[model samples]
Target: MKVVAIGGGTGLSNLLRGLKKEVGNRIEDLSAIVTVADSGGSTGRLRKAYHIPAPGDIRNCLVALSESEEIIQRLFQYRFKGGELDGHSFGNLFLVSLMDITGSFISAINVASQILRTKGEIIPATTEDIHLWAEFSNGEVVEGEENITEYGKTSKAKIVRVWIEPPDAKPPIDAIAKVQSADLIIFGPGSLYTSIVPNMLIEDIKEAVEFSNAVKVFVVNAMTQPGETDSYTAYDHIEAFLRTTNLSKIDITILNTKMPSDVVLRRYIEQGQEPVIPDVAKIARKGITVYAEDLIGESQDFIRHDPDRLTEVILRAVSHALS
Candidate 1:
C-alpha cells in the first residue's frame, strides 16, 4: 500500500513511530507531508537566521521514522540547556547546517533521513520560508503559527480562517506524486489550524487531495486543544478543517471512545481542555463512516492517541481503501 500522512510534529511523529514498523510488510510506500510554517522557539529563530523553511517538524518526523541506534536518536532530539544554543534541538541544527551545505532544504532533509536510516519518506509541504496567518472571529489578523493559537486564547476569539503567505509556495516534487498515487491519505491527529490545515493551504497539495481516489481519513483528536479547539466537538473538528481549507471530503473518521480517568479529566478541564465528544451518529450522517474506538493512552499525564492502537486503526483504514 502507498500511504501518506499529513500534519505537524508530536501527533504526526507519534503515528509515524508505529507506521514505520509496518513498512516493507503491510505497506509498500509511506510518505509524510509535514507543515513547515512553524514560527516559534528554536525553529522560528533558525528560520529567520537561515532563510529556510522551518526544520523542526521535519526533524521530529525523521527521528520518528528513524531506524538508527538509540544513541543516535537521542542525539538528534537533544536540546542544549543554559547556553547560546540553549533552546535549539540537535536535529534542527543539523538539518540547517546541511541546508547550507546541500544548497536546498529538501536535499538537507534527504541527507538527514539517510543518517537516521528512516523507514519511510518525510517531505515538507513547501520549501519556501513561509509564515502562517489567521484571521480571528474578532476581525484581527495574526501571523505566525504559535501566535494564532495564543491570540485566540488570550482574546477569547475563535479562528476565523487561516492561510499561508506567498500563497503560491510549492510542494516538493514527490509530495504531490505520493498523494496522487496514495491508496490512503490521512490528515490530522494534530493541531487543526496550525499543523494540518497549513498543508492544505498549498495549492497543488490541496488539489492533489481533492483529485485523488485514495480513501481520505481524518484521525480526530481525543481532546480539545486549549487555545485552538477549545470547545470543538468531533463534528466541529471536521467542519473546521473542511471549512478552513476547502477540502472536498473525508471518507472516514476515527474518533476515540475512551476518556482519561476523572483525576486526569479534572486536571485537563482546569486548564481549559476537555475530551472531544465523539458525535458518532452525527458524523456518520454526513455519508462519512465513523470508527469509534478505545484509542486512549496517557503520556506524562497528557492525553494522546496510543500509537499501537492508532497503527492498528490505520491498517484497518488501509483495507477499506483497498476494498
Candidate 2:
C-alpha cells in the first residue's frame, strides 16, 4: 500500500515510527505530509530568524522514521543546555544549517533524509512561508499557533475556526500527488487544531483528499488537549476535523477505549485535560466505521498510543479490505 499520513506534532511522528516497520510488508511506500505552520518555541524562533517553514515537527518525523544508528538519532535529537542555543533541538539546527548550505528548505529536508536514512519521505505540507491564525468563538482572532493555543487555554475561549496567513499556500507537488494516489490516509492522534487541522487549511491538499480513493481514517487522540478540544468526545473530534477541512466524511475513525491509572489521569485532569470519552456510537451512527481498542500505552507517566498495537490494527484493517 502507498500510505500517506497527514498532520504534524508528536502524534504524526509517533505514528510514522510505527508504520516504518511495515515497509515492504504491508506498506510499499509511506509518506508524511507535515504541518509547517508552527510559530512557537525553537521552530518559531528559527522561522523569524531564517524565514523558513517550521522544522520542529519535520525533525521529529524524520527522526522517528530514521533508520540510522541509535547514536546518530540521539545526536540529532540532542538539545544544548544553558547556552545561547538553549532549548533548540539539534535536529532543528541541523535542518536550518542545511537550508543555508543548500539555499532551499526542501533541499535541506532531502539532504537530511539521506543522512538520517529515514524509512519514509517526510514532506512539508507547503514550502511557502506560512503562519496559522485561529479565530475564537468570542470574536477574538489569534495569530501564531503557540499564541492561539495559549489564548484559547488562558482565556477559556473556544476556537471557532482556523486558517493559514496566505490562505492559499501551495503544497509541494508530491504532497498533492501522494494524497491523490494513497491507498490509506490517516489524520491525527494529535492536537486537533494546531497539529492535524492546520494541514487541512491548505486548499490544494484538502481538495486532493476530497478526490482521492484512500480509506481516510482519523485516529482520535487518547486525551483531550486543554487548549484545543478541551472536553471533546470522540464524535466531537470527528465533527471538528471534518468541519475544518470541509471533507464530507471519514471512512473510519479509531478510538482508544482504555484509560490510564487514576494517578496519571489526575495529573492530566489537574492540568485541565481528560480522557477523551469514547462516544463511539455517535460516530458510528454517521455511517462511518468506528474501530475501538485498547490503544493507550503509558510510559514514564505519559499516555500515548502503543505504536506496535496501533500499527497492527491499522495494517489489519487495510489487509482485510484488500483481501
Candidate 3:
C-alpha cells in the first residue's frame, strides 16, 4: 500500500508511530505531508531569524518514523535548558544547520531521514517560508499561526477563514506527486485550523487531493481544541474541511467513540476543551462512511488517540475500501 498522511504537530507524529508499526512490510511507500506555516516557539523563532520554513513539525514526524535506536531518538528530541537555546530542540537546530549546509530544505530533510533511517519520507507542504493568516467572524484579521489560535480563544467571533500569506504559494512537486499516487490519504488527528487545514491552504495540495483517486480518510480529533474547534462536533470538523478546501467529500471519517475518565476530562475542561461528540448519524447522512471506535487513551493526564487502536481502524477502513 502507498499511504500518504497529511497534517502536522503531535497528532500526525503520534499517528505515524503506529502507522510505521502496522504497515511493516505491507507498505510499498509511505509519506507524510507536513505543514510549515508554524510560527510558534522554536519553529517560529527559527523562521523569523533564518527565513526558513518551520522545522519543528518536520522534526517530530521524522522521529516518529525513525528506525534508529531509542537513545538516538531521545537525543534528537532533547530540548536545551537555561540558556539562549533554552526552549529550542536539538533536532530543530540540526535540521536548520543541514538546510544551511545543503542549501535546500528538501535536501536537508533527505539527509536527516538517512541518518535516522526513517521508515518513510517526510515532505513539507510547501518549500516557501509562509505564514498563516485568519479572519475571525467578528471581522478581525489575525496574522501568524500562534497569534491566530490565541486570538480565537478570546475573540467573540469564530474563525471565518484562513489562508497562507503568499496566497499563491504552491506545494512542492514531490508533495503533489505523493498525493497523486497515494492508495490511502489520511487527513488529521491534528488541530483543525493550524495543523491540518494549513496544508490545504496551499492551492496545489488542495487540487491534487481533490483529483486523487485514493481512499480518503479524515481522522477527527479526539478532543475539541479550545481556540480552534471550541464547541465543534464530528460533523462540524468535516464541514470546516469542505468549506476550506476544494475537496467535496471524505470517503471515511474516523471518530473516537470512547471518552476519557472524568479526572482526565476535567483537566481538558479546565482548559476550555471537551471531547468531540461523534455525531455519526449526521456525518453518515452526507454519504460518507462513519467508522467509530474506542480510540482514546490517557497518558500523564493527557487524552490522545490510542495509536495502536487508531492504526487498526485505519487499516480496516482501507481494507474495506479496497474490497
Candidate 4:
C-alpha cells in the first residue's frame, strides 16, 4: 500500500509510529507532508535566527518513523535542562546545523532521514518561510499560529478564512508527485487551523490534492480544541476543512465513538476543554462514509489518540475503501 499523510505536529508522528509497524515491508511507499507555519517554541526561535524552515514538527515526525537505535532516538529527543540551551531539543539544533552546512533545508531533511533510518520520506508543505494569517468571524485577523489561540476564545470568532502571504508559494517537487501518485491521503487529528489548514494554504498543495486520484481520508480530533475549535461537532470539523481548501469532499471520516474515562474528562474540563461528540448519523448524511472506533488514550492533562488503535482504524477504513 502507498500512503501519504498531510499535516504536522504530534498527530502526524503518532500516526506514522502506528502505520510503520502494520505496513512494514508491504508498504511500497510512505510519505509525510509537514506544515512549516510554526513560529513557536524552539522551531520559531530557530527560524528567526537562521532563516531555515521550522524543524520542530519535522524532527518529531522523522524520529517517530526512524529505525535508528533506541539510544540514538533518545539522543534526538533529549532536552537540555539548563544554561543557554535550556528547553531546546538536540534534534532541533542538529537540523539547524545540518541546514547551515548543506545550504538547503530539503537537503538537510534528506540527510537526517538517512541518519534516522526513517521508514518513509518526509517533505515540508513548502520550502518558503510562509506566514499563516487567519481571519476570525468577528473580523479580527490574527497573524501567527501562537496568536490564534487567544482570539479563538469567542464563538463569534470562528476562523473565517486562512491564507499564506505571497500566495503563490510553490511546493517541493517531491511533495506534489507524492500526492499525485498516492493510494490514500490522510488529513489531521491535529489542530485544525494551525497544523492542518496551513498546509492547504500553499497554492500548489491545494491544487495537487484537488486534482489527485488519491482517496482522501480525514481523521477528526477526539476533543474540541480549547480556543480554536471549542464546541465543534464532527460535522463542524468537516465543514471547516472544506471551507479552507479546494477539495470538495472526503472519502472516509475516522472518529472516536467512546467517551474518555470521567477522571480524564475532568482534568480537561478544568482547562476549558471537552470531547467532540460527533453526530455520526449527521456526518453520514453529508455524503462521507463514517468510521468510528475507540481512539482515545489516557494522558495526564490532555486526551490523545491511542496510536496503535487509531492506526487500526485508519487501516480498516482504507481496506474497506479499496475493497
Question: What lDDT tens digits, residue by residue, belong to model 1 across residues 65-156?
Answer: 99999999999999988979999999999999999899988889999999999999999999998899998888999999888889988998
Query: What TM-score should be assigned to candidate 1?
Result: 0.98
Clashing pairs in 4: none
- When 2 and 4 are scored with lDDT, the better candidate is 2
Clash totals, every prediction? 0, 0, 0, 0
RMSD of 1: 1.0
Could you arrange the candidates by lDDT from highest to lowest? 3, 1, 2, 4
Q: Could you give candidate 4's per-residue lDDT for residues 132-188 as a string of tens digits?
A: 888887888887787777678654467878888768888899999999999899999
Give the range where candidate 4 is weakest over 10 consecutive residues by summed lDDT: 148-157
lDDT values, one for every candidate:
0.91, 0.91, 0.92, 0.86
- Provide TM-scores for the models: 0.98, 0.98, 0.98, 0.96
lDDT of 3 by residue, 185-259 (tens): 999999899999999989989988999999999999999997789899999999998898757878999999897
Clashes of 3: 0
Candidate 1 whole-model C-alpha lDDT, 0 to 1 = 0.91
Off by over 4 Å in 2: none
Q: Which stretches of candidate 1 lie over 4 Å from their true place?
A: 298-300
RMSD of each: 1.0, 1.0, 1.0, 1.6
